[model samples]
Target: MEKVTREEEIDEIEKIRMTLGAHLEELRRRVVYSIIAIVLCFVFCWFFKVQILDIAKKPHRFAMGKAGLSSELQVLSYQEGFYAYMKLCFITSVFIAYPFVIYQIWQFVRAGLYKKEKKYILLFLPISYLAFVVGGVFGYFLLIPFGLQFLIGILGPGIQPIITMQQYVSFVFMLTVALGLVFQLPLVMLLLSKIGIVSPDKFIAWRKYAILVIFIIAAIVTPPDPFTQTMTAVPMIILYELGILIARPTKKGFILLGTAVGCGAIAVVGVYFYFTHRGGEINVSNPYGDIQILYPGDRGWKKVSGHMSFQKGITLKTGKGGRTVLSTKKGVNVGMDTNTEAHFFDSWKMQLKTGQILISMKESEIPLEVDTPNGRIRMNKGTLNIQAKDIVTIVTAVNGEATLLIEGEEKKLLEGRQHKMSIGGEPVDIGAIINWSEGIVTKSDEQK
Candidate 1:
């Protein structure tokens, strides 16, 4: 009997060793597959590395343009650009190969899971990739643009920023990857719940603690600024709430999740329409002395009061000693000076028939086109003063940049500079040009 027991023990030991060896082999195969995917992606990405770099540089360029600075990334050393390009291509490869790599990992691990466990994993595999992509898109579109704008332009103007290629690339890559990983909060919770480790009730009970930890993580992941940290933490808190909702595996939980998702989709659609449509009108405020608007087909100009809106093809006129402001949904602010006459062609284009107009754009992606008798001025993002007379047009770039086209000639106007159409360009005092618009105050400005 003792010999029989010894033989059984030996058999059990040999079976366990064989199982372990098989698992190791599977892991090796998965690793090889992942490496091959990454290598293939890297080679493809390397050929278009310049275009990738340009895409990465877009946010930085936008921030610099908004801040009225040059949009050039500096290189500290000769080899720095080469290494940065390599790193950039590698990061791009990882991003492209992430789904395939996850699939390889999933294949290796699925064999060890029970039927129920495998079902849950399979359900979450695509969802995990989708969440990661959403996180990356959020970082790229919203966070990077606004975060870099705040960070780079927080000091105001007059300070030139010399961001190095290595540092910039590292910052962007780290932030993107961190956000992508952080977005896995809900999946982690679902997995824990499926495994009987933690329940939805526990997640709800620990909400306060989780929020605290989320803020801490946001502070670590984002730049050391309240704006960026708050932006990151808010989304994390929302994800935490979502995790709690998803942790419940009952029918009621699914119904609640569906309702919440439906509401979110409606809200997003509503916001999109609000910005894109905006009733095809520009808002008017800060009517001082006398400000009047003439509709597209109106024969007479009507006096404007506290707040009003003008449709396209309407003409706005300011009497002597009068000033007012026109604002669009796209962040274009047009301040009409005393005795100014301008025609509101549309949301993005205006015709300055005569007098001076002060235009201040706040992070507007759409270009503002102002037509004058002498030339046409096009600016995507800037603060400038335009004076149109009978034969000549004067443009003073108080902040940011502008482009002037006249008589088949195009000129670039930089900040703190003045360009007289048909004449030339020269440096000017921004304060002098923008001082008149200071007196025109809207309710929001008054509250400020």
Candidate 2:
């Protein structure tokens, strides 16, 4: 009997060892597949290095245009350009092969997860890829351009910009990779929430602290300027808020309330647009006090009162007690509150230099785009209330929907939701929308 028991114990040990060996083999296989995918992607990116380089150089060109300087990036060392090209190819390859790597990782991890959790693996994989791409685009298009311009501008006039190929490539790569990782904010929050590590309530409670930390991070990552720092922080804050919203426990009552509010707000905006068919011009229906308008070639701001035509490259400023409302031909309306500064870069682009502006527009062929220190906002048919204060920009979607492009990702802001983005860094949804148009320069929120 003793001999039989010992033999059985030996058999059980052998089985355990076999299971361990099997897991190791599976891991090795996944690693090999991931490596193969990366190598293939690397070769493809290397082949298109010239095109990639051109694309990367766009922001630099834009910055130079803004600064009124024209120069090509230099190469100090004999192989500097070659090394830079190789680095770019490798980075691009990683981005291209990221999805396959994620798949391999998911395959390895899926074994330990339950069937329900397995669904998340599939969802996360695509989202991960999308987030990375969005982040890369954000770095390439917005942040890098603005940052390079600002840095060049601060150097003052007559100082020609000279950048090394290696330096430029490294800068671009660091910004792209950092943003790509940062854009994973939502996914990380969702995963933690799913595992019961964090909840929506916890995120809400930590709001103020999070804002502080976000700014600190922005200052560290971005160039030492309020604009760049605010830009970076805005997107991060928005992402954090989105994470909270995603993690929040779903409630039928809350959804119903939000739906009701959204419908009401939409109806109000629709009615306002229907009655006032004024083409893109400032409406002085009830001007609070006096305001100033500065034309592109004007020497100084001119005091204005009541109903002015909206023109491209026009600057509007409101004094301590002044208020104004401007509208576009496409039924796009902008209401500037007291102590606000706004510049219409073009018909489609408006920059909120400082203070608050409420925008309401119906879905049309022409999209109204607003630029702030944080990022860019594109609206079609939506009522958006944005406030710029210090280093933060608060955006609340009163009705319809708007798209926020920051850090290479486009986030949809739906009605009945409030989002806050750091003018320097990230973005977050702060929960239910409030009455943000209480004391607007245009029509009151209740009237709207």
Candidate 3:
């Protein structure tokens, strides 16, 4: 009887050893599959980069203004635009194909876990997806809007808001992703605690420490500003506290003691970077490198090396000689009187409804002409001759000065201002053409 019992025990021990060995092989196989999938997905994303860029820019096109209002503006350098959009594409491809990735991970880990644990983890798959989506939603719908509005509102008056498509898109996406990951804290804690990694008592004891760190994180994630930083920080702190509760293990101690404190400190540093500008006093510079069209709602900018001439908008129109209408508009509205010189011609043609107007001035080089049916604007500079007659006209300047000629005679309009001198023209009581480049300034929610 003793010998029979000994043989049975040996058999049972061997069975257990073989199970573990089998599990390890399964794990290796699944990991290999996951790596292969990611590589394939990344390669695919690279091939279709242009298509990916269009999607990433969708949010900016919608939020910046109406689609017909302006052309898409890229905030980064030429290289930056190419790379940033690629990064966006890679991230999106990974996310969209994440389910397959997760499934591969599960197949490897599944066999090692008991049936009950496997079932429970399977539930986590969907929950993880939900958490990610929720995080992104919180960022796009809530955090970004508030932050953007706050930055713009601060500009108040005397500023032209020129936000680039690249900057705008990147900023919104960053906030969305950061907030989404932050929202997944509870799930992360639950998993860690369930695995005997962290104990409940340890979490309760370190609650205060976690609270301090949460504020720090909030500061880092938000755009730098008292209103935005504090708002972002508070929620993060709350989430951290919630994380502790979720992670609390009744029997064991905490595991990520350092991670908790470290992430918190990082948050604070990020917030600090956001708010303080030019010795901690706020001054607006172009966030879009050399482009100075930063609107009132944007955050303070770093001192860019040089000026950025942001392409606010571009329009191709068919006129007598062909008009290239551009601004933050589909086309610029020009107004002029036949008697007006370059000075009066340079005055921005008011949207006439909104207080805003278009300022147009000529360059000394690129040859151009201005003529319309309204009154007319006459200007003379260098080798240019500007003439208008039929009705009132708005003049668009390229890079030359026009010799002002009115009613078959000649007169001095005014001198040309340097820069892409876009000044408003005077509109008749008849009204201004609703061109693409101008609008009445309006305040957004964050500014409020």
Q: Looking at model 1, how many pairs of residues clash? A: 0
For all candidates in order, the CA lDDT equals 0.81, 0.76, 0.49
TM-score of candidate 1 to 2 decimals: 0.56
* Superposition error at 166 for model 1 (Å): 1.3
lDDT of 1 by residue, 187-257 (tens): 98998898888988998789899989999999998899997887788777778777887777667666656
Highest TM-score, which number?
1
Models sorted by TM-score, best on top: 1, 2, 3
lDDT of 3 by residue, 68-162 (tens): 12325646566877767666766766667778888888866664465446666887788887888887776655556546545654653224466
Using all chains and alpha carbons, the TM-scores for the candidates as numbered come to 0.56, 0.52, 0.49
Highest lDDT scorer? 1
Residue range with the least summed lDDT across 10 consecutive positions in model 3: 343-352
Query: lDDT at 236 for candidate 3?
Result: 65
- After superposition, the stretches of candidate 3 with alpha carbons farther than 4 Å from their true spots are 1-32, 39-55, 58-63, 66-71, 75-78, 114-116, 158-170, 238-448
Please identify which of the two predictions, 2 or 3, would achieve the higher lDDT against the true structure: 2
Candidate 2 C-alpha lDDT tens digits along 304-408: 866666424568889999987777655777888999999875556789989998888877877788988787899878799999877778899999888888767
